[model samples]
Target: MEPLAFSFDQPLFQLASLPITAGHLVAAAALLMALVAIAAGRRARSLRIDERDGQISALLAAQTELQGRIATMAEVFGARQAELNQTLSQRIDGMTHRIGASISEQTKATHENLRRLQERLAVIDSAQNNIQALAKDMAGLQNILSNKQTRGAFGQSRMEAIVADGLPISAYTFQATLPNGARPDCIIRMPNGQPPLVIDAKFPLESWNSMRDAPDADRRQQAAQAFRRDMEVHVRDIASKYLLPGETQETAFLFVPSESIFAEIHEHFEALVQKAHRQRIVIVSPSLLLLSIQVIQAILKDARMREQAHLIQGEVIRLMEDLSRLDERVRKLQGHFAMAQKDVDEILISSNKLTRRGARIETLEMEATAPPGPSEKGERAVDNRMGQLKLRVVDED
Candidate 1:
């Protein structure tokens, strides 16, 4: 049933599957699986390479940015740190120098304060010594004033000193005896045309001191009454003694214990004061003493002025007499001057007239001495070639 051309030499195996064998099939299948495995391995390797590259690039970029940022931070930090160090160093140095300067200044100030304190202490010591000296002087003064007469004398001296400071001593005088044969303490001249005034100093010391130092009330009362009586008596006595008829009146002065005493006199002893007034006795106290002194000073000044005027009256009269004589001499000299003026006028007139005569004579002499020409001599001469030309104009009527 087979084809007759088939040769017996062909292998039965070849004829059964010509190119395809079991081994071939297995080899092809193995080859194909090997290629797929190789391709997958290459692709995985490429993808891993690409991912590595991208991660590497991102890391590189981040590294570069970090480097730059680190550099900038380093620069800024270094600069700030340097500046902080500089500022701190300057502050430390300044503080140290200031400490040294302050110590020096404090030492100097302490020394100066010590010196000033020493000077103040010395001044205080000196002032204390001066104050002690003043205290001793005051004690001596108090002792001196304890005596009534001494106190009165002190007052008088003070008043006199004040007067001497402001005015001359010649302006004042004291202890003038009135016409009543009683000597007053002082007298003052009045201004213009007023009367003179007198002053008397009185002190009922024994009675007043008795009252002041009395230990018992009754004794004090008795002493006071006695002192009052004594004062009244003195008031009348002063009026009688100092108040003369023409020179002074009953309006004389009586000095009392104090301003308080004077005021008390006006209070409780109003009647006595009235009586004193009727007797023309004015009572003054220490407070009123200045006014009295001023009055007296004015009077003394006026009196001195009047006395000086009286003394200069003679000189004034002499001066006036000399002035009258001078006036008379001036009149005589004026008369002499008038006569000299008249003589000058007469001389001037005579000299003028003589001068006029002399001028007329000189004119006559000059006219005679003038040279005369031929025509003037009553003849005319002409040269041989020249003719004398005379022109006569007849008047036509």
Candidate 2:
């Protein structure tokens, strides 16, 4: 027997060529229904796959756009961050520089202030030392001024210094004995044969001090009165002792060494000054004495200039005579130079004539030695003219 073969299109078992039974029909139907179901299922699966692909494509496109946007945002953020960092750095640098400059300025100012403070401290220390020294000097002066004779000597010395500073040594004399046998502190000789001016340096300082240091008004008044009386007595004594008939000046000086005392007398005792003036005794401070000495020096200088006037005139006259002599000598020398120049001009003319004559003689000799020219007569005539020029040159010499 042959092997049985099964085919989907063919009947399972064919009875003859006629074939076909109900089973076959039913199998074929079942197979067709299965095929239809499979087709439907495939169609449904294809539709579902298409829908999912569309959804996936849409999601990918959206993701790609989102990625592009994110990239752009990141770039923008980076650029902004770089700019912000640069800006921040610049601001930080600026702030740091400003802070450094401010700190430096403050430090310099602090140092300067400290230096100035140190200088001020040094100045204060120096000032304090000077004040201490001045206090010691004041104490010494007070001690010296306590004694009357020493005070008088001090006044005399001060007056002498002023007088010596203002006037020449010959113009003034110190401790000079007057014609009346009274020795004054200084004597200033007046010019033009005027009487000698006497200066007395002693003054009533005790009463003035008492008046200045009185306790109350009554005491001060009494002290002022005593000071006035003492000054009046001094003025009277100076006038009587120093003022001579023809030897001393009518106005004598009572020198007050202390400017303060002099000022006090002028301010508070005008009447006393007037009284002294009436007695021909003028009150003078050290400064006033210096001024008076200067005036006297001026007068003496004027007198000296007057005395030397004739000598100056004589010297000027001698200078004029000398100038006149120098002018005369200069004129005579100029005349001699003119005569010498004329002689030199004449010698130059003679030398020129001699040079011309010698040149002619040389030309004649050259012509005579040459072969006789076409005109020997002309050559002989040239020689004769050269001889004549030589004779004229000798005559000029």
Candidate 3:
């Protein structure tokens, strides 16, 4: 038993006017179906293409309107930017001007302050120079006071200066030798040839300095006692050496160079002062010495005035005598003037008498020369009588 073989070439059906086999029919059917499908696809493709063209046109119109709106917005933004730039430039210029003015004012103020500071520095420099000079002077003064001999010279110089300034050169003498050969520091010549006033310039300042520099009270007390003793001894020496009978004054002066030291002695040591007074030793500072010199000067002036009193009186007497002589001469001149005036009066009276006699003679001559008229004889007789009377008047004048 074999199975039947199926083949497309085996004819199973007939077609009009063509060889109709099963294979051919089936092939025809396949071809027809493919053609139908191709037609449907073509129709759908045409419709889709039309739709795409319409969408493209609408999109182009909308893009054109959007571009116009963007251009308008860009123009507005540019105008606003220009206005902002102008405002910013103006504000910057104003700010720059204000900053410049502020800087100028600050510079001026700084210059003024610097000038004032320089002036103050100059003044301070001058004061510093003065202070340095004063310091040097003080150092020199301390050096001079350190040594005993120099210290005595300093005191003596100070005393001499005071005396020289207050008195004439001849009135005071420096280092005058006495009768006993004891030389004193200075001797003021008294008025009217009295004894000279002796002054000693040597003072013991070492004990005073020690007393002042003592740290403890006991040491200060011991120094004070030593100073008092030294002062007493110096006073005794002055009294012994300078106080001379009929040579120097009864009292002698102990010159203290320093005013503060003199004040200290007077304030702290009353007993020492009293003892010196009893010893006829007078302690004198520069001011006191000057005062005494002035007193001596006044006394000298008074003595000079008294000594020249007789000369002044003689001058006054001579002036009075000269005045009396002048008065007598003036009286003689007045008497001569009176006699001259009387002589002038007598000459004036004689001139008036001569003028009257000349006028009467002229009148008589004119009457005699005139011619006689109707009563010639009587007229002639009257004229002769008048002529005789005129002649008698002239003789009397």
Candidate 4:
């Protein structure tokens, strides 16, 4: 059945005025009963809409309370914002100050470091100049060593320099004659002042230089043979010239070629070394020479030290004489000083005695000027103590 739309102001009930026959009256009654059921269903729907409206009003009141809470929270947030801003400003200023202070300190430290570095550089510059001058002098000295005429002086100066670095120069003497009547280059004294040990520095350098200048292997080999032969002859000659019995304590030293040449001789010629050793001639290279000079320098230094002891003993005797004279003079001065002190003491005694006499005279004068006391005014008619200053009845009174 289809239901009709209902309006609240208009009544859903309707009355039908009808004229009907006995058979149509029942059909009309059934139609009225169907309209009553539709009206009841519409009324129930309206009751449900009223219940929903009441619930909506309660929801609106809750929304109003929540808005008031939001407004209070906003005010509190505004005050907190102001406090946070103040604290943030102070922190920013402090941080800025700390950053600035750190920057300033770093800059100052850097400046001080730079200044110190610059000062050190200046010192280094001065030291560099001194080093340069020393190097130049050394180069000039080395240049002088290349000449044959100055070679002896070179060898002597170099050897002396080496010895003087650790050993004293007084240990050796210039040009000593061996027992064989041959003069060696230099000799150092023994501790007992015996004949010094012999060493010869003169060697054939031109021939070695000639061998160095050879171009081919054949020429070089020939030069090598010549150089070896010359060395053998040199060794024999040195032994014959310097090695003699009762001349020196040790075998004579034959100073040879440079270190390289000495190395070559040892590498190539063992036979020559044995022959030379048999002849009592030991070839010394530069390194070996250094050791020899040290030994020789020690021996001579000990001898000189012994002589210096005698010299010192003589000086001590002279000093004792001077000390005796000095003591006599000191005694005379002490006697004079004592006399002066005694005179000063006597003068002080005389001054003290004069002061005591002046005090006594002042007392006598004061008593004469003062008037007589009332107790004994006319009793002293004899005037016995006219010039005397009286105090009590003890003395001449």
Candidate 5:
């Protein structure tokens, strides 16, 4: 085969019936080359388009997976948020309950404390009022005791109260006149024919009070001497006036009416006490007077009881004799009742026998009246007459 030649300057087709030159052939060849290049470029463009489509498919698949993951994450987040909300709500409710209970307890305790405080305050106010009333009473008592006459009256009243409380009205007499035309403050009558006891209530308190209230030792000594002289004089007067041989007891009581005065006398005036004792005079304070009065009352009671003892014994003996006689009479009466019962029983027995005889007589008479043989009729009549005779005998008995 001949060598195949390639023509670079040849036209592949005629355009318009004109012979194309080499330059034209060259241009056509260039054009043809350009066309071939353009076709290749178009193929490359198709390849690039296919590659882009594949990348876009892969991206779409990735996007779909990412979307599914986001949806799952959102669901989980929603569930977790709901759980946290519920937990928080539960904790808040518990805290509210605890706080409410605590507040209620605290309020109750506070109210209790307030009530106790109010009660204490009321008690304190009552105590304050009592203290004030006591102070007023003390002031009144001080005023009453300031004057000599009122103080004497107060002491006398106290003595009277003690006497009235302890002794019966008939046992004591106030302001009794003695046989010597001297009047004693009080006289206590003794039972069992004993002599009466005299009590003098007037006392010399001025000197004693002066001695107690003296400003100096010298003044106190002077006041004490005066007190002793005044007490001795009073005691002598009481011993002379109240101690009547037949009318009053040998010992007379000089009532001081004040315990303080009595204590002072005993503490400072021993010689005066001895003098009064020699004169058969007893110096007594209010408490000592009360005790002496009680002793006298007891003695009086015992004496009265002793005086009545014989009469009581006589009465008891008579009562015992009467009880013995009553017992004997009751025994005699019981014996008489027994005898009467026996007689009544005997009479009832006789009455029963009479009734039986009368019933037999009635039966015999009825039989006699009935039709019978002559002998039988004679026997029945005889039995009826015999039964009548027995009933008459029983009636006599």
Candidate 6:
């Protein structure tokens, strides 16, 4: 009655109440193969993901360790840098201080050297001024020495100065007139009523100058002969004028102003010196005259000492008498001091006893109640103790 239905899935058999077909079996087998392929792919993907995760963790750990090491190295380097900076600063400061000190020392040394140089320059300047003054004096002296009368005056003046310096005003007289109306340059009064010693400062130096100025040996010889004759004549004159037996010393001094001239005469003219000495005329240079003055002064001093010998002896006797009286008075004073010392010792003993009694009284306590009455024997013992306590002062004088 119905139209026949053509179908691709035809039921081959019925199992229980379900119809089974070939198309259904084929679809089930294809689905199972697809599920197996999908499961295997998922397992391989999970294994790859686990391996990548392990590698990432290892890299992160390594990076963290490297960062820690870098931080530690940075800290060490910073500390080293700080130490280096401090060392450099200290060295720089030390160098700066040393350099400053060196500069300061150098400045002080320079100033000291400059001061020394200035002092030396000042001394040189003073020396230059003194040299100028000395040159002027030399010129003046040459002018004075050129004239005969001025030269004689100069010699006399120099001799006067020497005598005045050596002898007292009362001991010597300048331009003293003798009994024979002969005037001498100086006269030194001798002690003990002896005749005064005479000094003559006049000397003839013209022939000496001529001899020194001679151009030839013959002229020099002639000038030297004249000089000798002049010297002999001057010596004779001095002897006749100054060597008066009753008025002046038997020996008279002929003063030569120039030491060089005196030396020259002594060296070249031995005969003249002997002649002068024989005639009681002693040729003396300034130094020799000074020595003679010293000798005369010593003689005068000895004579004065001899004259006062009696007075000195009398004074010594008086001093000895005074010293004996002083010794006797000192002995009496010592006896008096011994008595005073004994009195002082006794006073000290009384003071010590009073001090001990005062201490004993201070230690005793005051009581309001009266002490018990004493027996007759106890009263006698108390009286003896009180008598022992009484102070006795001794007088030594």
The digit string of per-residue lDDT tens for model 1 on 129-181 reads 99999999889877755787886665456544544454455544467777778
lDDT of 2 by residue, 1-397 (tens): 9999666566555667867756677887999999999999899989888988988898899999999999999999999999999999999999999999999999999999999999999999999999999999899888878888888888899999999898888888999998789999999988888888999989888887788889999999999999988988888889889999899889999999888888978998999999999998889998888888888888888999999999999999999999999999999999999999999999999999889878867875676455556887979876786687668667856
Candidate 6 per-residue lDDT over residues 275-329, each given as its tens digit: 9999988999999999998998899899999999999999999999999999999
Candidate rank order under TM-score: 6, 2, 3, 5, 4, 1
Worst 10 residues of 5 by lDDT: 364-373
| Model 4 TM-score on a 0 to 1 scale | 0.46
List the pairs of residues colliding in candidate 6: none
Q: Where does model 5 exceed 4 Å of error?
A: 1-141, 318-397
Compute each candidate's TM-score over C-alphas: 0.43, 0.64, 0.54, 0.46, 0.52, 0.67
Best by TM-score: 6
List the RMSD of every prediction in angstroms. 15.5, 10.1, 17.9, 10.7, 13.1, 13.4
TM-score of candidate 2 relative to the true fold? 0.64
| For model 6, the run of ten residues with the poorest summed lDDT | 388-397
Off by over 4 Å in 6: 1-99, 215-218, 348-397
Q: What tens digits encode model 4's per-residue C-alpha lDDT throughout 277-343?
A: 8887787887888887777666666767887998989999999999999999999999999999999
lDDT of 6 at 310: 100
Per-residue lDDT tens digits for candidate 5, residues 276-331, read 99999988887888898789889878878887999999999999999999999999
lDDT of 4 at 323: 100
Return whichever of 4 and 6 wins on TM-score.
6
Worst 10 residues of 2 by lDDT: 364-373
Which candidate, 4 or 5, has the higher lDDT? 5
**Total backbone collisions, model 4:** 0
Global lDDT of each candidate: 0.71, 0.88, 0.88, 0.72, 0.83, 0.87
Model 3 compared with the native: what TM-score?
0.54
